[model samples]
Target: MSMRVPGGGFDSTNPIRLDFPQSLAVYDDYAAAQKAVDFLSDNVFPVEQLVIVGTDLKRIERITGRLTTGRVALGGVLSGAWLGLLIGLVLSLFTTAEQSSLAIIVGTLLFGAVFGMIFALVGYAMTRGQRDFSSVTSVVATKYEVLVEHKVAAQARELLAGLPGGLPDPFA
Candidate 1:
């Protein structure tokens, strides 16, 4: 769906611009691609005409650690305690000066710890030893390409050529 920006130039309705876009430059990393665009913007070039597209996508997953019953219970306890402390603080805001907010916070913390431990233990047991490892996954791109409307591709290339090592080597 097309999002109406302040200026009606970008047609976000389509992933790729239907009005032919030509590659202005390609960089190994996104930062370099972004830098090129920023440079163009600083030079008063039509930034709206440019788009950075990531290609050669890859999904990487890093195994953090093996999960154990004790570890799970400890993690749950810590998270629950934090949540309980937040709730207690919010609730205590409505209490009168005669009521001790400390008592409420401490009571909630204890209850949270117990509830957390029980839930953690039960969840771990239900897992049946499946998915016992923790991991983080990310989708990354190998290359980032700067695309500009075909009409302004030449101007973009010329502007980019002024930047240090901005142009990709044709020999390599």
Candidate 2:
């Protein structure tokens, strides 16, 4: 006769954490994570069952889309300033008897620089301090985990075991 156990034989000591359930395979590079996903897919794993969670939200966003609005605005302001300077120079060249005056050139350059700075600052501030403004570095976290759907968790584990890396279980 089989002995009766409570909660369908699930040990209280093994209470599953719904937030982060399985294992983590930390790769030094994102390419590795992508390669792992590709390999799993090639082996008949459906894409829907796998999720690539970027540890860095900004990096993921950038990869999935074109330049952010701040970058775009900054670029536009810079380009517009340069164009304006060129137009001003041309106007001065035609209007002045000899050459563009130093005053005009300096004034235009100063105005352009100030405008560019203001636009950049405003664009950056619009992000509400969610991103870094001083640098263009593709910010990413040290670790990113590939979450598997609960239904295909066992298959994922099996496929991972067949791969080169061993998945390490992480805890809070």
Candidate 3:
């Protein structure tokens, strides 16, 4: 059985869902939730009847470094260079008798680097110092919950009972 995400423009099976899911266990970390599922799998509990859900979503951004003009320019140049290189290679693939592949590639690479650097710097400048630091951002769940199809919830819960420390459920 499958479901479609509303307005997600999807016309295929949705693997992120379970039918009549019941929370079998919840844990503070994904590992714990995964461990419970692993235990169920080990006990032959028809693992297909399970799903792991991350709850209490939180967005975190870890600052990597401070941004500078030179750094921005270099980053842009490298990015643009890569794009240019890709375009050049594609164009070179259909090179004619009068066309030189080496020239095409070199030209594209240089152009890409220059364009990338300029674009990067311009974008950074437009940000107007609002965001000056480089950082990586990610959304994480504060807790993970192991859920099972309603029909197999009991079986899964029973199997998880054998885990070394057993599963912990604050709500239970």
Task: Assess every candidate by TM-score.
Answer: 0.82, 0.43, 0.86
lDDT of each: 0.84, 0.60, 0.83
Q: Give the clashing pairs for model 3.
A: 76-116, 76-117, 77-117, 80-112, 80-113, 81-112, 81-113
TM-score of 3: 0.86
List the candidate 2 regions with Cα displacement exceeding 4 Å.
1-24, 56-80, 83-134, 166-172
The number of residue pairs in model 1 that clash at the backbone is: 0
> What are the per-residue Cα lDDT tens digits for candidate 3 across 90-124?
99999998999999999999989988987999999
Please give, for residues 88-116, the per-residue lDDT of candidate 2 as tens digits: 67666755656546667666766775677
Q: Return the top candidate by lDDT.
A: 1
Model 1 whole-model lDDT (C-alpha atoms):
0.84
Q: What order do candidates take by lDDT, descending?
A: 1, 3, 2
Clashing pairs in 2: none
lDDT of model 1 at position 124: 85
Candidate 2: C-alpha RMSD after superposition: 14.9
Evaluation by lDDT, superior candidate among 1 and 2:
1
